[model samples]
Target: MNTAVPLDAQSRRALLQRISDILLRPAPTWLRIDAEGTSAAQLYKNYLIYLAAIPALASFIGMSLVGVGAFGMRLRVPIAAGLVNLLVGYVLTLVMVYVMALIANALAPRFQGRRDMPSALKLVAYGATAGLLAGALGIVPALGMLAAVGGLYSIYLIYLGAPVLMKVPRERAVAYTAVLLLCGAVAGMLVGWLTALATPGAGLGQRGAATLRLPGTDIRIDAHSVGQASRRLQEAQREGDGGAATRAATDAIGAMLGARIDTGQMDQASRQLEQARARGDSEAAAEAAGSMVSAALGGKGLPPLSAQQLRAVTPEQFAGLPRTAIKAETNNVMGMAFTQVDARYSQQRQQVQLRLKDLGAAPALAMGMASWASSTSESEDEREIERSYKKAGVAFREKYRKDGSRSELSILLPTRVVLEASGSLPIDELKQALQPVVQQTTALARPPA
Candidate 1:
């Protein structure tokens, strides 16, 4: 364009048309290769690609982390630093992929063909393997060259391998892979950058705004308490001296926490700031944030907060909790985990219960699967053992639901059994539960003596 001739209208149009032909020229005559109806053959190769890709990605993440952890002395340093770096690198790698791919695609030749699913899967596998190798090698700061090369190489390799995998022209595969990587990298960077920039509340987009409200009433609280605070705040507003009125009402009700602190900032900054500042800060924002000292209890410090004061605490305070309190909090977490594990076992027993329900609803199939109480053979006797397992399973499940905190009766099989043959039910008081029943059902299937 800079070296263009001064042609007007028709002359310029003719020159532009000639320039287009020259610019859009194809490969050298000798280098041109044809696809030859091998599209179907290439698409079927996806299985091999997947065979290579899946294990590589999984192994890279798992093994690398483990390998880093194996250095017990350096574990504290590298593992901690590596994980944070890996997260950042993983994001940056995506950006790199897009840039490499885009240029390859725009400049490379394209050949149109039907998508071969097998070939596509294979291509992904190859690409994944390339990505994994690059990332794993990059873990050794000095060997990071592998990551850079492997990441870019994966795209080129995908393009090169596309023809064999997808049965398309090699040129087309190269072009597509190159462009795809470039676009993908650009997209990844943008997404990561945007996420980094977003404030925790603002990250949820319009939903965040809709959740919390902004108002001027001297006292502040989260949305959960806003409805309750609104009426009282409105009355305070009518009383004219807003800040002082809010303080007077708040001090009178010494237990009300919303009088001084803003709850929204509480979640973001946490309890550290609340515990730190005490009335002498000069900055207006800092001064405004100070909590009002109540003389109700005559200087016995702040009121004692309950266990459920989580909503009132800030994130920083939560992180920097006193050691003993943290351990107590940890126990609470473990207790929840134990409950979930018990629930999982209960769910498995419920599946058996559903099967029992079907026995009552659809007798024919249930009988076929063995709903009958009568023994057909020693093999049929085996079903009784299976039935007992189910019964015990359900019993333990019920016990779990009642009081999972008991900690002692947490197993699927109890120590006591209530083995029933044909009774209505055992009403004996304080019957001790027996231990696990170990009946061999596999041996019962053998020929009878």
Candidate 2:
């Protein structure tokens, strides 16, 4: 018989203690959990239920409230849809944990270990503590990748627990863990696919109450529960030390996870800029834009160049070709204003277009543009040749047609500027036309004093 356990203050404290112990001292914690006669129902009711919700609720708040952003575009999942997906994913996670425990018990015999369901459940549940706790990072979408590092750590926990709880020989524990991980990965993919399908625009509509049908069960999400959860989450945020904990965890995880650009800050600054613009507060808007620029620059906190300065660096003529058209403008992206200069030179049927973009304020975009810096490739066919390589400390990509009718050359400067020349001319001619523009833009791309 199973007995229900109420999740009171003591239970919550116990849960936290267990999580910390499992993470910081897995070897001893596994032994303690193995010796305890805890039932699967009690474990699920007191531990897995709350821990799994960390990811589900955090993801809901993140996707629907904080939103997701990249390359100056922000996307927020519909509130009702996000709630629906959260419920579906949460249920799937709980089920998957139990299923994994069952698999662990079944594989115990094959690994020359004891087949104790209770021990298997304890191993799977406690071993997943690190991953479940790390799921809180989903609250900031940009930091979500760091969660995978925690997941990797969970694998290590499982490796440690497999030998303790499952009683598997240390020599065969690696194989046992490998098989379980493969199954877990497949189950995870299925859960993600199903949850995505339940969201709006993913084979489902969000016009009203969302309903999802699973095997032998129908899950319906009403607006009332969604509203209640949102209200409670907001209250918790206002009343709890979640903010401080999140910052501390972020710093600790970042030190282990390495460098990653968080675009959420830029998205928030963009919203502030928009609100300021709505109120016609130019000063506030400028401040918000500056913040956005700083975020985009990976915290370098450099101001963006003005349109006139960018235009001044553009060449009026190139390779004896007269300038035919020139235009300079300031474009706003995610609240950060960037200067771009475009110029065209033409003589007879030959034409070359030069574009100089100041990407100093958008280091993420600049990194993406110059991703081929460490890569080198070349291919030549009967009609065209294409190659990407680094030259003289600059990343360049070039393509030319054998007929000499079209060519393109792109250069990524170290100062975070992108210079490109393309037109109906030879590749050499295009490069020649861009040489002076590249030199000038390189000088102009310096950080503001």
Candidate 3:
């Protein structure tokens, strides 16, 4: 609730000095900060704003410009999508700092600490300095994992500050820190989920490469060399040789910033595409186009399927139920295309619905489902049983009622397709009906011929 006051040049220098003191001599600095009269608004306007931008801007450059290397290739997110992510992430981070402060204030009384808003804000904002500064490592995508060390150090900073800022006894600081960390972790996950939803293809640490291509020309920028250079840079850093690490970093940056097109490969591809077009070979032409699209999308998506292809795989009946209705559609958004099919079946009082969706170009959705692939869980009560687990390398979730009046099943295929079945039938029967459809759809997931 505290208001901001105008800060002059001298005040700004003192604020900057606080960062080094907090990092190097946190124990004494916490006492000094506890006595300061700085308001919440001033802390945010002069400190947190700039501190939070470090990670956001670093991530933007890392993903949109520097890119990541995988499978001997370099992949960068399209600049426009990266910009959106940067904005969303930056705003969310600022809010998260404030939320953590609020949590600290609320939990202070339980730990025998005073509930003071300004003190709580100072504890969080200053404690986050190490992690925020370390965000610069993101400028080199492959080294991003190293930033976790900074986060671990930040937890120590908070632990040092808790007794001074919140008036908690030294003995209770550890318990307070653990609870605060658990809350921060949950908030971080929520923020990540929201950011992914806002920017679909802007997921961090995404694999694959994107080639630079002109619309009506054969010119292309191959990033394979850049990818190789980045790997070497990572190795040099790991060896802890300062000179070698600096040189490798420079080499990697130069490779990415320089225009190094492979003329011979470009000419060969152009010739093959021209030949396919001149000969009226539609299949060959389509295949060539599909490859280009895949490269542009970080080498992860399949070409759009035709309406006939989707309809052909959709089942007309399930088990002994008669088909009631069916629908298939392809939707294009932001130059990316995906398909979905829906079908309904019924027999007297029994009914079922099935849906198939392609996740080739939907990286965010695919990443969300991929988390389930490595996890297992199950729970049951008197009326129903629910379980989630991986089978044959595929992720599945199922629930069924004891009376057999309702059941549902969801399967995430390795090919990035999601199949769902729900209705009045038993869960086992629903899974049985989906076997044929799953096989056909998996076959259709291959690249265009």
Worst lDDT run of 10 residues, candidate 2, spans 212-221
lDDT of each: 0.27, 0.65, 0.66
TM-score of 2: 0.48
Query: RMSD of model 2, in Å?
Result: 17.7
Q: Which candidate is the best by TM-score?
A: 2
lDDT of 1: 0.27
211-276: candidate 3 lDDT, tens digit per residue: 211100101112354457657766775687656754664444334322112222333433555567
Winner on lDDT between 1 and 3 is: 3
- Candidate 1 vs candidate 2: the lDDT winner is 2
Of the candidates shown, which would achieve the greatest lDDT relative to the real structure?
A: 3
Question: Which stretches of candidate 3 lie above 4 Å from their native place?
Answer: 1-12, 70-72, 201-449
Clash pairs, candidate 3, are none
lDDT tens per residue, model 2, 64-140: 88897433335899888888877876777678778778878887886679999999888888887766777787798
**RMSD vs true structure, all candidates:** 29.0, 17.7, 19.7
